[model samples]
Target chain A: MTEQLVLNYSIAGDDFTKAGEAAADFKTVLKKTGVPPDIIRRAAICMYEGEINMVIHADGGDAEIIIGADKIEIILADRGPGIPDIELAMQEGYTTAPENIRSLGFGAGMGLPNMKRYSDGFDIKSAPGVGTTVKMTIMLPKNRE
Target chain B: MKIREISEILGAEVLCCHELLDTDVHSACGCDLMSDVLAFVKDQSVLLTGLVNLQSIRTADMMDMKCIVFVRGKKPDDAMLNLAVERGIVLLSSPLRMYIACGRLYSAGLAGMSEE
Candidate 1:
């Protein structure tokens, strides 16, 4: 059978108020595609976390969502100061975000962790000064890990 | 317990979704960090935090939570209230701090999701 549909988005990093716009739109797309609530939730968590990363670190980037029959894949690519230490960044409590970001309910260093936790597939590629890109996938039913 | 019961327990004033006061939330979590909320919370329970911002309501909506109780007399602004109304979530403000409010609810049998 042919794939259901594909969704693409470009996130804006200019304003913090609009950080979740793309993710929220992705969520709407998922809802319209007949994804279950729990699966939609998994997708939402991953996309929102990635969206936040794009805003907080990358100053904005692009997100492409490929919604297939078996799974949904969200590839988020950003050009920001890449992580010097992926290991430390993956740690639960580690965060380099400024104090002001913490006031906004982010910078908890849990973004990547939560993304990994909610996603069936999580992979990250980064270079210290180049940029960072994260790919997270959520599978439905038997497609899930 | 129901959201209304919890509101009464904390003497909190409902800021939005007054109609949802009867919604049942069996668990509660207290945290100022939205990251911790994402890392730990589950099952659409109540969120107790002192953080006053749009992200707080957004976090609750993302978690599929039923209600948010702002402790330490933290009052939410118009943006936050508007978001709560849009999401159909119960938003309340309590004069109690984070620890005391969570403790009171815990002692009254509102268990954490992880504890169960």
Candidate 2:
């Protein structure tokens, strides 16, 4: 617990079926680290939503997770078309994902909002043509120490 | 209620994790949208959805749900079943539609997610 554990994953964008694998893998790792189940669930939800967004909107992305003693940080960065209006994108039920995605049980416009809801710290940086980067941090429970 | 009772109530076929059917689930959520399920659901151990895809399984796994009932006779494909097996999530295919399935479960004492 003294050293930070860093994990990196490359999310494949073309396959919708594989979207949450990274988050699932990370969830296992977190469980093995003895993190509380509630904290693990929150971190898993945040990463899963971010992974879905990267696949649905961005082509693909890199997810970097840093697990420290007091907090878990998730950084998702994608080199795809970025959001034009972060404000609008943050609103619930305001997704731009197409019909196919909705049919697959996503794109309800709750991704970003859900990520923010479960994370203790949330931030996003996007440029219309460049790409987007999202950083979310979940604080571990005080009792974990 | 236990997952076995849920399967019996909905006339659902247990697709995987049959050994876990005796697991108890206190609350449930019925939704087709994974995002909404992830956003609104809290500590709900059962998910009833018509959406048949891998994301449904993944969402349930993320929420730490124990069982997923595919309503409206929807069946999950092999890949999804395999994933559910790995995640230890019980998969059920029910003939009942979304509304009837939810109502039946609620009537059977399975509560929905609490309004927060």
Over 4 Å off, model 2: A143-145
DockQ of all candidates, in order? Answer: 0.64, 0.94
Best by TM-score: 2
Q: Tell me the deviation in Å of residue A106 in model 1.
A: 1.8
* Error in Å for residue A119 of model 1: 0.9
Instruction: Kindly report the docking quality category of candidate 2.
Output: high
Q: Candidate 1, residue B56: CA error in Å?
A: 0.7
Candidate 2 local lDDT, A1-145, one digit each (tens): 6679999999999999999999999999999887989889999999999999999999989999999988999999999899999999999889899999989998889999999999999999999999999999999865464
Docking class of 1: medium
Q: After superposition, how far is residue B13 of candidate 2 from its true place, in Å?
A: 1.0
The 10-residue segment with the lowest total lDDT in model 2 chain A: A136-145
Clashes of 2: 0
